[model samples]
Target: MTERELIKKAQAGHNSALNQLLLDNYSILKGYLIKLTLQKELAEDLTQETLLKAVTKIQDYEPRGKFSTWLIVIGKNLYFDYLRKNKNLRNYEEYDSVEKNRVGNQEASAEDHVISGLTFEKMRETLGTLSREKRSVFILKHYYGYSYKEIAEIEQCPIGTIRSRLHNSIEDIRRVMEEEGLDGF
Candidate 1:
């Protein structure tokens, strides 16, 4: 069945259809939450909360945007709420542990893994310097390949504001990279 059909059924109180809908969009939503939160465990928690919200609020979902995008919006709002309530603190130790535990490419040599890990760490550190709102714009646009219009809609801001935030985010990252002698910006 098409996504529209599934959504219709989900909205009509079909548990199977709702489960399928969540399953279909789970990876996209989780990946987005990971990028936004930079903490795998917290992202997982937020992903679960977002899915629960979807299950409870399926009837309110509109069909104008992709279901994945709707899930992202819900997840994003939950993350921001979490930040506000928790005073915007992130557990970097948890992120580092997660990164270290990630499996390296089997085809690549150990040196490649080390270099890639260093580069990723540098980039992540740079991203950490950005404000949550700016970081979200950057991650949504660059990491998730969201368009400015889509980001604006998800961010609930004007397109110009989204553009400005993205510009500033890029400049900040570029400046940090240059300062740290990192190339390939």
Candidate 2:
């Protein structure tokens, strides 16, 4: 069935239709959540929450765009809500332990191994320093391969704002990498 039909059925109280809609768009939603949160468990939890919220608010959904877009908006809001509650405090010890394990498991023969580690660390630090809005645009555009137009729609901002954010983010990353002496990487 078409998305509109599925949405109609879902709004009409068809549980199966709603489930199908969620199932069909699950990966997209999960990917967006993961990119936003950078934590698998948190992303999964937010995905479920987003789906539930979408279902509850399904009746208010207008057929203006793809249903998946609406679902993603819900997920994005939930992700921000999680961030607000968590207040950017992460377990640095756990993060370092995981990084150490990952580094040890890497092959010695890997290309650019010497610079790769520094580059990645620098990039992570730089990304963390970016404002939430700029980081969101960068991740959605580069990591998730979202178009500027789609990002604007998802972010509820103008396309020009998305473009500007992405541009500024790339420049910031470049400057940070240069300062860290890993620009060649």
Error of 1 at 168 (Å): 0.5
Per-residue CA lDDT of model 2 for 55-128, tens digit only, reads 88989999887777888888877777776687763542231122111122232223133324345556556666
Clashes per candidate (backbone, < 3 Å): 0, 0
Please, what is the TM-score per model? 0.79, 0.70
Q: For candidate 1, lDDT tens digit of each residue in 74-121?
A: 999899789868876465223112211222244124323323433666
Best by lDDT: 1
Model 1 off-target regions past 4 Å?
89-118
True lDDT of residue 4, candidate 1: 96
Q: Against the unseen true structure, what C-alpha lDDT does each candidate score?
A: 0.76, 0.70
**TM-score of predicted structure 1:** 0.79
Give the per-residue Cα lDDT of candidate 2 at 141: 67
Candidate 1: Cα lDDT at 104? 28
